[model samples]
Target: MSRPQHFGWFLARGFGPHGWGHPYLDWNYRWTEPALYQESVRTLEQAGFDLLIIEDAPSLGSPATIDLRVRQAFGGPKHDPLLLAPYLFAATQHLGIVPTVNPAAYLPYTAARQFATLQHLSGHRLGLNVVTDTGSARHFGTAPPPDHDGAYDRAEEWLAGIKALWNSWPEGALIADPARGRYADGTLLGHVQHRGDYYGFDGPLNALPFTDGEPVIVSPGGSGRGLGFAGANSGVQLALAPLDRESISAYRAKIHAAAVEAGRAPDDIKILFAIQPVIVSSAEEADRVVAASRDPDDAAIAYIAEKQSSDLETDLTALDLDAPLDLSVFGGHVSQGSIARLVGKHDVTTTPLSTLLAAHARLGRISDRTGFVGTAGEFADLIEELGDWGNDGVLIWGDLHPVTVHRILDELVPILRRRGILRSDYVTGGLRANLQAF
Candidate 1:
């Protein structure tokens, strides 16, 4: 297999709690402007993004404090990611849709059938982001004695079963005959019976593997169990978010090393980092726009603090805006502790009050992290730096959807094409074929 250079876009718009913090009903109104999804997919297709990673959660929950607003916001029926991919694939020829699915809640047969059907319909424009049940166990109401590691043990069996099911049908199984009115040959359809630690499944996956081998496999698991899962199964792409150069390099090396251990080529996996690029026509204009996207009020900041670590109501309201933010108040670092590590790595010590206050305005910036907040050329320069700093590419994010998408497509993409870092037109084929892998 020829290893193609990898790059992809992430779509967490409807289900992820990562953006804007809008209520569920109001989410589509604010985060996604009218027709933005179609436009964004087109932009990605035109820009030669390898695939669009679509994230989905069966349910949303915080491990620590239950943020009632957050829960209420996500409590409604969500857009089924697997169900949505066909429509998205129909709309675009080259862009692949990788939807995240939890292995715990659904059966392997059902999951396999749905994905196979999707691959058949889209001509194989699909990828899988396998999220083990660890991160959302409590949220799913399946109280776990099995830690993430245990869940992953179960996940291995699930993956194996899924693969067996996908391969159940032999090649040339479909022979539509008019004389006898036969649609398929029974000899081609084989049974896959599996009885494992976590699950017992039997039969041929009730669908055809597209003319291609299968949809691409992608995952974002960095934990030991997640790593093993990715190494054993993930082939085309891997997703991650690292705040600094050292972490980015380390993560890339880790992925390459994992591939080697898995008996796969080291460069087989592509790395795409998650970033919300706030680009505008000018540097000052970009900064102004980014600042505007931040909440000037305390409620949102407090909510972020609660989600990230411990409660910080007392210390958050008492610091100078210009001073370095201190991490002393939460006793240590809280949830998303990497934010703390990034701060300490850059020597950005400040009162919790100051950090919270600044978070409401500066967004995820500490003293040193960089975001694309400038003219098209400047954004391109930063993107190149990220690539040189050892990332395969950057996955652009928006503070607000359509606005961000419009600016990126109009501004940044053209500059990238001129610089030869991004393609001017999509390669012809399904998602995997466009990415140039078997």
Candidate 2:
């Protein structure tokens, strides 16, 4: 099937009823209110957003730390991604629902069954974003956590196991024979066994996943392990850096190379990037909003310190912000390439601590690279450029409330439609079908 142009919006948890803001934390809130999220999803569906990425926090890690406290203060409650799925499905006809899953926390079989059921219910509109976390292992409630490589090792096997279970049962295996009282064909559930370095599993999953191939398996970015995993799994969409053409090209090349190494077609892997759009009626208005929402230099520094939780307050504050990050000083503790890029942008050696903080504050939506911040026409241009440069689509977030992102659906979608870059209406099926992965 031909690849369909894909675009998405992310809805996260908020710290308050109005926004994701929290007084204790330096960073502003990310998730809007429930009513806003619902409205946003519907608007995005109409605007032709191929998917809506509803972030799920299973374990309270670094980011979730902020969310957890906020929830407590707000008198406790809200729907998680899983519960939100059915609502979104009912609200929109074609938009995809991608809920992130961390393999270490969730069982492979259980996750497979959950996603499979969602796909079945949404008519295949579900997609899985597999995340093997690195930085915040302490939050997993394990005293001694596995290393990054170790986590990926287990994750790789877990993913393989899930895929095996998905394919274990063939179509027509479930006769549901009411007269005979036999629900399944006993011989059809193929057993799966694996004794790899990090994981060991046996037999078919209790419940079959696809009965067909399954939902789109989406991978975020290119780590060595992530690339290898995607290469082994065909039809996986790879999410990469948004807006930067150079990064997009490089990522696509890496994905294709990984696919070739794994004996799969290069084009089988789809590449997407994060786009934090700041849309407005005029270019000036967009710029103003972007600037207003950003953190001050000192605030940025404090936020970084809080994020790292290293507590080397004096030493961190002593460094100059204009110099490149001292790799020797920050070798092991930092998270991934994503965070690394955020630090790399500002030279922290000579600049003042406050200066450094503000510079690195608004890390670009995708990998800290500067991206779209203009009128509707300018955004359309950026999207087209991304496509031409080899990225499949963008996973978007906005600076302000629903208005900034909502405008994309209202304004930019129409422009994309006019340019033949976006679909005019629902394509007759679910997320997987719309993505042309069917």
> How do the residues 1-438 of candidate 2 rate in per-residue lDDT, one tens digit apiece?
122467777543322233434342333333433455566677787787788765544433344233433333221233356666776677767787776677766666677677777788887787777767654456556656667677767777788887787777767777888999988996977877767765566767666445334777776646777777777663545464534667677777878888899888786665666766656688667666567647655565666644332221123434545464454554343446744454555554554445544564553221122645677788777777666665677777542245545555667787788886776677665665676642
What is the per-residue lDDT of model 1 for residues 259-361, given as tens digits with 9 covering 90 to 100?
Answer: 7888987656666777666555665676676677565566555454443332221233344545666556442212233444325334564444445444534
Model 1 error, position 399 (Å):
6.6
Give the lowest summed-lDDT range of ten residues in model 2.
Answer: 69-78
**TM-score of each prediction:** 0.77, 0.78
Best lDDT among the predictions, by candidate number: 1
* Deviation of model 1 at 7, angstroms: 3.8
Candidate 1: list runs displaced more than 4 Å. Answer: 1-6, 15-36, 62-77, 135-145, 172-185, 236-238, 241-245, 286-300, 306-372
Model 1 residue 247 lDDT score: 79
Error of 2 at 163 (Å): 1.6
